[model samples]
Target: MSERTLLVIGAGGHGKAVAEAALLSGEWQRIAFADDRWPALCETFGWPVVSDVAGLAALEIQVAGAIAAVGNNAVREQWVEAIRAAGLPLITVVHPRACVSAAATIGEGSAIMALAMVGVDAAIGEGAIVNASATVDHDVSLGDFAHLGVGVHLAGGVVVGARAWLQAGCSAGYRVAVADGVICAPGTVLVVD
Candidate 1:
């Protein structure tokens, strides 16, 4: 199959990371960006910022796939849904240094960053971010658009709800349940109930 083109939605730090990952993978030939904040001025990682999401429809070019790189879960969720509704393909990205089990399942538009580990049967939901050095243990499930900050750890069978953000260095106990929209502060320790 021919290589696909990627349009990264968002032009912030996380978006730059995603663009770099895509470029390093060499799976896609063309990488462009879309953001509400226009005039990206210069390209990121050698890829130009094409247009804003509002202008996506007027491009007249085919975008093989797209990924929402927004950091906020709510915004990420919205953009992912918008792209999906537009009939555009959503793609997932895994950093070269990340380790993912064969039994693990990562949904579309999700990103597993450098040094992250996804264990057996762990299900990462669509548009979720498993940030650098984060760990999702066996049988854990992360709901759509969830964000796991750097060094965060989810023990076996843990369930993280939609749009949740587990901040950096935080660790949740085995079988812990984090409710939707929950924001665990940095360095927090969530004990199992």
Candidate 2:
């Protein structure tokens, strides 16, 4: 609605996906990528690669907000911090096709991709990622930088700790608690163990 521009850090696969989702959201008037590979990697998904990580300072006046589109949780957190320190607001990106309940809370710098379902009262922490086709049921709590890979499903009331990663096709049953920094393999199914 306003004259807002988004600077997405990271020009890799995850970054491209985030940028595409952001574009589909139609929330930003302009969007650009800033990666360490800037000059060598001039563009991604038809978007210009404007600057590198070190160049972020110069972009403070150019972009209204930013988001780290990195797949690595720890790296994303670091980029988010840098974006914050640069006085750029961290924005949440949700694809138009994603079914996110109005009661759900999506944190700053988080990205919810196409076909993802974020249920009522679900809490998505800062810099988190709900990748394509992921399903987070009601009352699920995802900590900061947590990543739910494509097709991953978390049943109701699941609590996933910070930096936890549930790889593709993984499924967790109701009320399951995943500790911080845990990395669940693809297709992994969690019971109430």
Candidate 3:
């Protein structure tokens, strides 16, 4: 059987992390990048920029899956939808060092970074990010396009709403519901009931 080709849909730092996760996953044979600003055949992140939307049709034959690595919640959502419309399966990338429970369900386009822990039955939504060393306890729910920055911790039963951003080192108590589109400051603590 041939190996799967994955397209990394950004050309930035997060995109590099996502590509590295894909590599760590060990399922993708070849990796390519696509960005709005890159030329059709330029090299970035040690990979080729196949093309943005304009070249998806031509590149589709070589790309079996894609992940939108954009860090911005709104742009990530848009890229997720665009990749769907183009009929490419969005890949969920979990780094090799991450500990994800078997009962956990991670949605497509999500990235579980290195050393992150996703506990039992945790539900991570599409395009969500669990950055390096973050902890998502059992029964936690991360909504679509939500981001948990590096070292953020969510106690069991925590619910992070759609497009919410928890900055680095933030921690939330159990049963907390972070509102949608909320931009939490770094190191913030929420003891919501």
Candidate 4:
């Protein structure tokens, strides 16, 4: 069977991580990037930047699946919508090095990056980005479009609301609830009240 190419949405830093994760997954033969932000920058990290998903449709390229690697929750959600609207399947992209439990459920358009860990029964929501080396503990519930930045760690039973952005290296205590639209500063630690 011929290897399939994957269209990675978002050509930004987050997009670069997603493309790296895709490469680690070994699921695609080739990786292509689409970004609405940099329409003129034709190449990213030595990979071709073929415009956004809508542009991909215009180019009529065959993509087996896709994932949005946008960091901002709103932009990530928008990319998801655009990818779907462009008729590309939004896939769950995970790095081979990430330790994801079989019981854990990763939603569509979610990317689990290198060395990230998704514990048992954890639920990662749609368009969520589990950045490099981050940890989502067992039984955690992550709402739609949540972004756990690099090295962020969530204790067991933590509930992250939709569109929340937990900054890099932040640590949330067990059972803590981070509400939607919360943008945590780096290295902040949350303890159970």
Error (Å) of candidate 4 at residue 35 is 1.3
Ten-residue segment with the worst summed lDDT in candidate 2?
A: 56-65
Candidate 1 ranges with C-alpha deviation above 4 Å: 1-3, 40-42
lDDT of 4 by residue, 1-193 (tens): 7988888887778888778778767887788888775567788977888775557567456779888877889987987888887778889888999999999999998889889999999999998989999999999999999999999999999999999999999999999999998999999999888
Q: Give the poorly placed runs of model 2, Cα more than 4 Å off.
A: 1-3
lDDT, model 2: 0.92
Q: Rate the local accuracy (lDDT) of all candidates.
A: 0.89, 0.92, 0.90, 0.87
Pairs that clash in candidate 4: none
Please list the Cα RMSD from the true structure of every candidate, rounded to 1 decimal place: 1.6, 1.4, 1.6, 1.3
Report the number of the highest-lDDT candidate: 2
Write model 3 residue lDDT over 1-193, tens digit each, in one string.
Answer: 8877789888789998888888877987678998887684477768888787545656745788889998899999988888888888888999999999999999988999999999999999989999999999999999999999999999999999999999999999989999999999999999965
Question: Which scores better on lDDT, 3 or 4?
Answer: 3
Number of colliding residue pairs in model 3: 0
Candidate 1 Cα deviation (angstroms), residue 80: 0.8
Q: Which has the better lDDT: candidate 1, or candidate 4? A: 1
The TM-score between candidate 3 and the true structure equals 0.94
Residues 1-193 of candidate 1: C-alpha lDDT, one tens digit per residue: 7767799999889998887777677777778888887664546667778777777666556788999998899899889887877678899988888899999999999999999999999999989999999999999999989999999999999999999999999999999999999999999999876
**Number of colliding residue pairs in each model:** 0, 0, 0, 0
